[model samples]
Target: MLSNTIGETKTARNFFGIHLSLSSDMLRFDIYKEDGEVFEDLAYRALKIAVMATKRKQIRNLPGYYKGVLRKLIDETYFKDMFMYFDVPLGDFYFPENYEPS
Candidate 1:
Protein backbone atom coordinates (compact mmCIF):
# COMPACT_ATOMS: atom_id res chain seq x y z
CA MET A 1 0.00 0.00 0.00
CA LEU A 2 3.01 2.27 0.48
CA SER A 3 6.87 2.48 0.16
CA ASN A 4 10.22 4.29 -0.18
CA THR A 5 11.84 7.71 0.93
CA ILE A 6 12.83 9.99 4.36
CA GLY A 7 13.21 12.89 7.19
CA GLU A 8 15.24 15.18 9.55
CA THR A 9 13.30 17.77 11.69
CA LYS A 10 10.51 15.31 12.50
CA THR A 11 7.54 16.74 10.70
CA ALA A 12 4.87 15.03 8.58
CA ARG A 13 1.96 16.49 6.63
CA ASN A 14 1.49 13.53 4.24
CA PHE A 15 3.86 12.55 1.23
CA PHE A 16 7.43 11.08 -0.45
CA GLY A 17 9.37 10.03 -3.58
CA ILE A 18 12.38 7.93 -4.64
CA HIS A 19 16.00 8.14 -3.32
CA LEU A 20 15.21 7.28 0.27
CA SER A 21 17.35 9.55 2.39
CA LEU A 22 18.70 7.42 5.20
CA SER A 23 20.73 10.08 6.95
CA SER A 24 18.45 13.08 7.56
CA ASP A 25 15.99 13.73 10.37
CA MET A 26 14.00 16.40 8.56
CA LEU A 27 11.60 14.98 5.92
CA ARG A 28 8.85 16.12 3.61
CA PHE A 29 5.36 14.58 3.60
CA ASP A 30 2.94 16.82 1.80
CA ILE A 31 0.86 15.68 -1.15
CA TYR A 32 -1.02 17.82 -3.63
CA LYS A 33 -4.32 17.25 -5.40
CA GLU A 34 -3.95 16.87 -9.14
CA ASP A 35 -5.55 19.17 -11.70
CA GLY A 36 -9.33 18.92 -11.23
CA GLU A 37 -8.55 16.18 -8.76
CA VAL A 38 -11.00 15.88 -5.91
CA PHE A 39 -9.14 14.61 -2.90
CA GLU A 40 -11.43 12.31 -0.93
CA ASP A 41 -11.20 10.62 2.43
CA LEU A 42 -9.89 7.36 1.05
CA ALA A 43 -7.28 9.20 -0.95
CA TYR A 44 -6.11 10.84 2.23
CA ARG A 45 -6.13 7.45 3.93
CA ALA A 46 -3.97 6.00 1.21
CA LEU A 47 -1.58 8.86 1.73
CA LYS A 48 -1.62 8.17 5.43
CA ILE A 49 -0.71 4.58 4.80
CA ALA A 50 2.04 5.55 2.43
CA VAL A 51 3.47 7.94 4.98
CA MET A 52 3.38 5.30 7.68
CA ALA A 53 4.97 2.85 5.30
CA THR A 54 7.83 5.24 4.78
CA LYS A 55 8.27 5.67 8.50
CA ARG A 56 8.19 1.92 9.03
CA LYS A 57 10.92 1.58 6.43
CA GLN A 58 12.80 4.36 8.19
CA ILE A 59 13.12 6.23 4.88
CA ARG A 60 14.27 9.87 4.93
CA ASN A 61 14.55 12.72 2.41
CA LEU A 62 14.74 16.40 1.48
CA PRO A 63 12.00 18.56 -0.03
CA GLY A 64 10.51 17.58 -3.41
CA TYR A 65 10.43 13.96 -2.33
CA TYR A 66 6.63 14.03 -2.28
CA LYS A 67 6.53 15.58 -5.71
CA GLY A 68 8.91 12.99 -7.01
CA VAL A 69 6.77 10.21 -5.66
CA LEU A 70 3.68 11.78 -7.15
CA ARG A 71 5.35 12.04 -10.54
CA LYS A 72 6.50 8.47 -10.40
CA LEU A 73 3.06 7.26 -9.39
CA ILE A 74 1.46 9.23 -12.19
CA ASP A 75 3.80 7.56 -14.65
CA GLU A 76 2.99 4.22 -13.13
CA THR A 77 -0.80 4.61 -12.81
CA TYR A 78 -2.71 7.67 -13.74
CA PHE A 79 -5.95 6.72 -12.10
CA LYS A 80 -9.04 6.68 -14.27
CA ASP A 81 -10.94 7.66 -11.16
CA MET A 82 -8.79 9.82 -8.94
CA PHE A 83 -10.22 8.18 -5.88
CA MET A 84 -9.26 4.94 -7.55
CA TYR A 85 -5.79 5.80 -6.37
CA PHE A 86 -7.12 4.74 -3.03
CA ASP A 87 -9.07 1.80 -4.35
CA VAL A 88 -6.66 -0.93 -3.42
CA PRO A 89 -4.81 0.77 -0.67
CA LEU A 90 -2.96 3.36 -2.67
CA GLY A 91 -3.59 0.99 -5.55
CA ASP A 92 -1.11 0.73 -8.41
CA PHE A 93 0.52 4.02 -7.58
CA TYR A 94 3.20 2.54 -5.41
CA PHE A 95 6.80 3.23 -4.55
CA PRO A 96 8.92 1.41 -7.14
CA GLU A 97 10.64 -0.47 -4.35
CA ASN A 98 10.14 -1.23 -0.67
CA TYR A 99 12.77 -0.24 1.85
CA GLU A 100 13.06 -2.15 5.10
CA PRO A 101 14.65 -0.38 8.03
CA SER A 102 18.01 -1.69 9.15
Candidate 2:
Protein backbone atom coordinates (compact mmCIF):
# COMPACT_ATOMS: atom_id res chain seq x y z
CA MET A 1 0.00 0.00 0.00
CA LEU A 2 2.97 2.26 -0.60
CA SER A 3 2.74 5.16 -3.06
CA ASN A 4 4.90 8.01 -4.34
CA THR A 5 5.36 10.19 -7.38
CA ILE A 6 8.57 11.01 -9.25
CA GLY A 7 8.43 13.56 -12.04
CA GLU A 8 10.89 15.52 -14.10
CA THR A 9 10.53 18.05 -16.87
CA LYS A 10 13.19 19.25 -19.27
CA THR A 11 12.89 21.94 -21.88
CA ALA A 12 15.22 23.11 -24.57
CA ARG A 13 14.71 26.07 -26.85
CA ASN A 14 16.29 26.74 -30.28
CA PHE A 15 17.55 23.21 -30.66
CA PHE A 16 17.60 22.84 -34.46
CA GLY A 17 14.66 25.24 -34.80
CA ILE A 18 12.57 23.10 -32.51
CA HIS A 19 11.38 23.56 -28.98
CA LEU A 20 12.10 20.30 -27.18
CA SER A 21 10.29 19.28 -24.08
CA LEU A 22 10.59 16.04 -22.20
CA SER A 23 8.62 15.01 -19.16
CA SER A 24 8.01 11.79 -17.26
CA ASP A 25 6.10 10.55 -14.29
CA MET A 26 6.87 7.41 -12.32
CA LEU A 27 4.76 6.01 -9.54
CA ARG A 28 6.82 4.16 -6.97
CA PHE A 29 6.10 2.26 -3.80
CA ASP A 30 7.96 2.45 -0.50
CA ILE A 31 7.38 -0.19 2.12
CA TYR A 32 7.00 0.85 5.74
CA LYS A 33 7.55 -1.55 8.59
CA GLU A 34 9.08 -1.85 12.00
CA ASP A 35 12.71 -0.81 12.15
CA GLY A 36 15.28 -3.47 12.98
CA GLU A 37 18.61 -4.88 11.93
CA VAL A 38 16.91 -6.65 8.99
CA PHE A 39 15.60 -3.37 7.60
CA GLU A 40 18.41 -3.14 5.08
CA ASP A 41 17.71 -6.62 3.75
CA LEU A 42 14.00 -5.90 3.37
CA ALA A 43 14.66 -2.58 1.66
CA TYR A 44 17.09 -4.14 -0.76
CA ARG A 45 14.60 -6.84 -1.73
CA ALA A 46 11.89 -4.25 -2.27
CA LEU A 47 14.17 -2.20 -4.52
CA LYS A 48 15.11 -5.28 -6.52
CA ILE A 49 11.47 -6.08 -7.14
CA ALA A 50 10.62 -2.51 -8.10
CA VAL A 51 13.48 -2.19 -10.58
CA MET A 52 12.70 -5.54 -12.21
CA ALA A 53 9.06 -4.60 -12.59
CA THR A 54 9.89 -1.27 -14.16
CA LYS A 55 12.42 -2.78 -16.53
CA ARG A 56 9.90 -5.37 -17.67
CA LYS A 57 7.24 -2.74 -18.26
CA GLN A 58 9.64 -0.52 -20.17
CA ILE A 59 10.85 -3.35 -22.36
CA ARG A 60 7.34 -4.47 -23.12
CA ASN A 61 6.20 -0.98 -24.05
CA LEU A 62 9.33 0.25 -25.82
CA PRO A 63 11.93 -2.44 -26.27
CA GLY A 64 14.17 -0.54 -28.65
CA TYR A 65 14.10 2.71 -26.72
CA TYR A 66 14.57 0.94 -23.42
CA LYS A 67 17.57 -1.01 -24.66
CA GLY A 68 19.20 2.11 -26.04
CA VAL A 69 18.64 4.08 -22.86
CA LEU A 70 19.83 1.19 -20.70
CA ARG A 71 22.96 0.83 -22.78
CA LYS A 72 23.71 4.53 -22.49
CA LEU A 73 23.31 4.47 -18.74
CA ILE A 74 25.55 1.40 -18.46
CA ASP A 75 28.22 3.14 -20.49
CA GLU A 76 28.11 6.40 -18.58
CA THR A 77 31.11 7.32 -16.43
CA TYR A 78 29.01 7.82 -13.32
CA PHE A 79 27.14 4.54 -13.67
CA LYS A 80 29.34 2.71 -11.17
CA ASP A 81 29.10 5.64 -8.78
CA MET A 82 25.52 4.65 -7.95
CA PHE A 83 26.58 1.32 -6.51
CA MET A 84 29.82 2.65 -5.03
CA TYR A 85 27.99 5.25 -2.97
CA PHE A 86 25.86 2.53 -1.40
CA ASP A 87 28.90 0.30 -0.81
CA VAL A 88 27.37 -2.33 -3.07
CA PRO A 89 29.28 -4.12 -5.80
CA LEU A 90 28.16 -3.74 -9.42
CA GLY A 91 27.91 -7.52 -9.78
CA ASP A 92 25.10 -7.52 -7.24
CA PHE A 93 22.83 -5.69 -9.64
CA TYR A 94 20.45 -8.19 -11.26
CA PHE A 95 22.57 -10.69 -13.21
CA PRO A 96 26.16 -10.80 -12.03
CA GLU A 97 28.75 -9.78 -14.56
CA ASN A 98 32.34 -10.93 -14.48
CA TYR A 99 33.33 -7.88 -16.50
CA GLU A 100 31.55 -4.68 -17.37
CA PRO A 101 30.60 -4.40 -21.01
CA SER A 102 31.98 -1.57 -23.07
Candidate 3:
Protein backbone atom coordinates (compact mmCIF):
# COMPACT_ATOMS: atom_id res chain seq x y z
CA MET A 1 0.00 0.00 0.00
CA LEU A 2 1.10 3.57 -0.59
CA SER A 3 2.77 4.99 2.49
CA ASN A 4 4.66 8.17 3.41
CA THR A 5 3.81 10.01 0.24
CA ILE A 6 0.15 9.66 1.01
CA GLY A 7 0.56 10.76 4.61
CA GLU A 8 0.87 14.41 5.46
CA THR A 9 1.01 16.58 8.50
CA LYS A 10 -0.03 20.19 8.42
CA THR A 11 1.57 22.47 10.91
CA ALA A 12 1.19 26.11 11.90
CA ARG A 13 3.29 28.12 14.30
CA ASN A 14 5.36 25.05 15.14
CA PHE A 15 2.25 23.26 16.28
CA PHE A 16 0.69 20.41 14.38
CA GLY A 17 -2.74 21.39 13.08
CA ILE A 18 -4.07 18.40 11.28
CA HIS A 19 -2.60 15.10 10.20
CA LEU A 20 -4.00 13.24 7.21
CA SER A 21 -2.54 9.77 6.82
CA LEU A 22 -3.84 7.73 3.92
CA SER A 23 -3.62 4.01 3.42
CA SER A 24 -3.96 2.57 -0.07
CA ASP A 25 -5.31 -0.88 0.77
CA MET A 26 -8.79 0.19 1.80
CA LEU A 27 -8.65 3.95 1.51
CA ARG A 28 -8.21 4.03 5.27
CA PHE A 29 -7.34 7.48 6.67
CA ASP A 30 -6.45 9.06 9.96
CA ILE A 31 -6.82 12.69 10.91
CA TYR A 32 -5.33 14.00 14.09
CA LYS A 33 -5.89 17.64 14.77
CA GLU A 34 -3.63 17.57 17.76
CA ASP A 35 -1.48 15.34 19.89
CA GLY A 36 -2.48 12.60 22.34
CA GLU A 37 -5.42 10.21 22.41
CA VAL A 38 -8.67 11.37 20.85
CA PHE A 39 -12.14 11.01 22.22
CA GLU A 40 -13.72 11.97 18.92
CA ASP A 41 -12.23 9.75 16.25
CA LEU A 42 -15.60 8.98 14.68
CA ALA A 43 -15.36 11.86 12.22
CA TYR A 44 -12.09 10.58 10.85
CA ARG A 45 -13.33 7.01 10.92
CA ALA A 46 -16.46 7.98 9.02
CA LEU A 47 -14.40 9.73 6.38
CA LYS A 48 -12.20 6.66 6.02
CA ILE A 49 -15.25 4.43 5.68
CA ALA A 50 -16.72 6.71 3.04
CA VAL A 51 -13.48 6.78 1.10
CA MET A 52 -13.17 3.00 1.29
CA ALA A 53 -16.73 2.51 0.12
CA THR A 54 -16.28 4.96 -2.72
CA LYS A 55 -13.12 3.24 -3.89
CA ARG A 56 -14.69 -0.20 -3.71
CA LYS A 57 -17.60 1.09 -5.80
CA GLN A 58 -15.13 2.39 -8.41
CA ILE A 59 -15.99 6.00 -7.74
CA ARG A 60 -13.22 8.49 -8.51
CA ASN A 61 -14.55 11.94 -7.84
CA LEU A 62 -14.37 12.66 -4.13
CA PRO A 63 -14.30 16.44 -4.20
CA GLY A 64 -17.83 16.58 -2.85
CA TYR A 65 -16.77 14.76 0.28
CA TYR A 66 -13.81 17.07 0.68
CA LYS A 67 -15.99 20.13 0.18
CA GLY A 68 -18.56 18.87 2.64
CA VAL A 69 -15.91 18.29 5.27
CA LEU A 70 -14.36 21.71 4.70
CA ARG A 71 -17.72 23.45 4.73
CA LYS A 72 -18.70 21.78 7.95
CA LEU A 73 -15.37 22.41 9.65
CA ILE A 74 -15.00 25.99 8.53
CA ASP A 75 -17.11 29.09 7.99
CA GLU A 76 -18.60 28.16 4.63
CA THR A 77 -20.13 31.54 3.81
CA TYR A 78 -16.97 33.42 4.68
CA PHE A 79 -14.76 30.98 2.81
CA LYS A 80 -16.97 31.17 -0.27
CA ASP A 81 -16.84 34.95 -0.22
CA MET A 82 -13.06 34.80 0.08
CA PHE A 83 -12.86 32.25 -2.74
CA MET A 84 -14.95 34.43 -5.05
CA TYR A 85 -12.31 37.12 -4.87
CA PHE A 86 -9.77 34.64 -6.22
CA ASP A 87 -12.02 33.50 -9.09
CA VAL A 88 -11.45 36.69 -11.13
CA PRO A 89 -9.71 36.29 -14.46
CA LEU A 90 -5.99 35.97 -13.88
CA GLY A 91 -5.20 38.11 -16.89
CA ASP A 92 -6.88 41.01 -15.14
CA PHE A 93 -4.30 40.86 -12.35
CA TYR A 94 -1.08 38.91 -12.97
CA PHE A 95 1.49 38.98 -15.74
CA PRO A 96 2.08 36.03 -18.06
CA GLU A 97 3.71 32.96 -16.56
CA ASN A 98 7.29 32.04 -17.42
CA TYR A 99 6.34 28.34 -17.53
CA GLU A 100 3.91 26.79 -19.93
CA PRO A 101 1.55 23.89 -19.29
CA SER A 102 2.62 20.68 -20.97
Assess each prediction's global lDDT (C-alpha) against the native: 0.40, 0.33, 0.38
TM-score of 1: 0.29
How much RMSD separates candidate 2 from the native structure?
17.1
Query: How many pairs collide in each candidate, listed in order?
Result: 15, 0, 0
Q: Please state every model's RMSD to the true fold in angstroms.
A: 15.2, 17.1, 13.1
Q: Candidate 3: where are CA atoms >4 Å away?
A: 1-40, 66-102
In model 2, residue pairs whose N, Cα or C atoms come closer than 3 Å (at least 3 residues apart or on different chains), thus clashing, are none
Top-lDDT structure, candidate number: 1
Q: What does candidate 3's lDDT look like per residue over 1-102, in tens digits?
A: 112322433212111112232112112324323422231243344345545667677645443453344334334322347756776786677655785657
**Candidates ranked by lDDT, best first?**
1, 3, 2
Best by TM-score: 1
The order of the candidates by TM-score, greatest first, is: 1, 3, 2
TM-score of each: 0.29, 0.23, 0.24
Off by over 4 Å in 1: 1-35, 38-46, 79-102
Give lDDT tens digits, candidate 2, residues 15-89. Answer: 111111110111121332232223333333333444466756653433234334433432352245654568666
